[model samples]
Target: MGRVTGKRVVITGGASGMGRATAELFAREGARVAVLDAQAEPGEAVAAAIRDAGGDARFFRADVSVERSVGDAVDGAAEAFGGLDVLVNCAGIIGVDKPTHEVSEAEWDAVFAVDVKGVFFATKASVPHFLTAGGGAIVNFSSIYGLIGNDEFTPYHVAKGAVNMQTKQDAASYGRHGIRVNAVNPSTVLTPLVEGIARDFPGGLPAYEEQMTGHQSLRRLGRPLDVAYAVLFLASDEADWITGVVLPVDGGYTAR
Candidate 1:
């Protein structure tokens, strides 16, 4: 408990799924949280819940794809929480799953806008504050699909690959400045969006789960908290020396 005590955290996509779980966990550990998302109701609800639970939390509506929106939200978080200690880039999209030849240019661009560009926008906005404070942690949500190849999901994989490389580059560039950057690559987690996707699969949710379970040595799908715990570790002081690495929270899926 209290691993991130007194830290001020800004999490994009904090309204739901892994982002929400992380926000709740960070708040529980004594961090002041700012949840940024396009979804107003759920975002505000998350903040209210945190406050009701005796944690300092607030919600700010922002679109990750827009630089100005990202900048404003980061600045707002810094202002509200006194200063930003951690920035978690959890805002992302899967886009339409299609082969490279079949995917449209617009499709590719759209995914890049949110998946890859959003990370850049958020990190870019936070870097100055981190430098001012002498240090900070950045945890980006990449995907197992980014590390490996698949016939479908070209844009998503490429964007995540870009994110992974960016994480390494940023880590190298800012390590001397006390800024640490890392990314978490998770396999398909059982979020609502993923679950809905699974329902459309050939054999539906059961078959999808079975296949996913088999892909991981742990033989189970990942929960939001599973990934959230890893994000917490990377964002916390315990990982002060850990930077420039891509950590896989894949339930051992990468081992296979």
Candidate 2:
């Protein structure tokens, strides 16, 4: 049951969706979790829930897009846990859905600020701590769009591609020191945000689900836990020999 026993983990965007699921799962598997997010209330609630369930957890408020915020938050969590063992960069946005030509500079910058720069900031801040510990693990949340292109969310796809490269580069940079860095590319997961969108779709939730699942070989949208399990594997010792890999948890969406 203790897949990550005694590990200390810091998860960005732990307040909701896949990030929330990863936090909870890590805690359940015996990791002391730090839930870092801009959403104070929900982040606190997530921490409280974990504590209520007899898990070690705390909430740290931080804007991932800012270097200082990420640095402070990572340090705080490491201090609180006595050291850090893992970092999960899960906070991201779909950004403006316009094509590259129609996108404004500001819009493009905004998406990269969070999706790309946030990953950089968090990883940069965590490296020193990992170096101190002599080793650590990092699981970045990229997307299927990072591996394959679609017409929508061009900025997001590009940012995630950057993340994939970042993952590999850092893995190469740190592997000799025992640090492992990997990324997971998730397809259309049925998170609350997606559910809301489906509800408002022209043909309602059923049609939206069908359309979304049509491209996937599994013919169904993902659940947060599905991706969380992959994160857990990458973060755990079982994957100690695995680094610089971009695993797809997309229900075979890329296969097609």
Please give, for residues 1-256, the per-residue lDDT of candidate 2 as tens digits: 6999999999999999999999999999999999999999999999999999999999999999999999999999999999999999999988888898999999999989999999999999999999999999999999998999888889999999999999999999999999999999999898876787788888987898798889889998899999999999999999989999999999889998
Worst 10 residues of 2 by lDDT: 190-199
Residue 56, model 1: lDDT of 88
lDDT of predicted model 1: 0.93
lDDT of 1 by residue, 1-256 (tens): 5999999999999999999999999999999999999899999999999999999899999999999998999999998877888999998899988988899989999999999999999999999999888899999999998899977788999999999999999999999999999999999799876988898989998899897778688877899999999999999999999999899999899998
Give the distance in Å from residue 111's predicted Cα in candidate 1 to where it truly belongs: 0.4
* Superposition-based RMSD of candidate 1 using all C-alpha atoms, in angstroms: 1.0
Clashing pairs in model 2, backbone N/Cα/C closer than 3 A: none
In order, candidate lDDTs are: 0.93, 0.95
Q: Among these predicted structures, which one has the highest TM-score?
A: 2
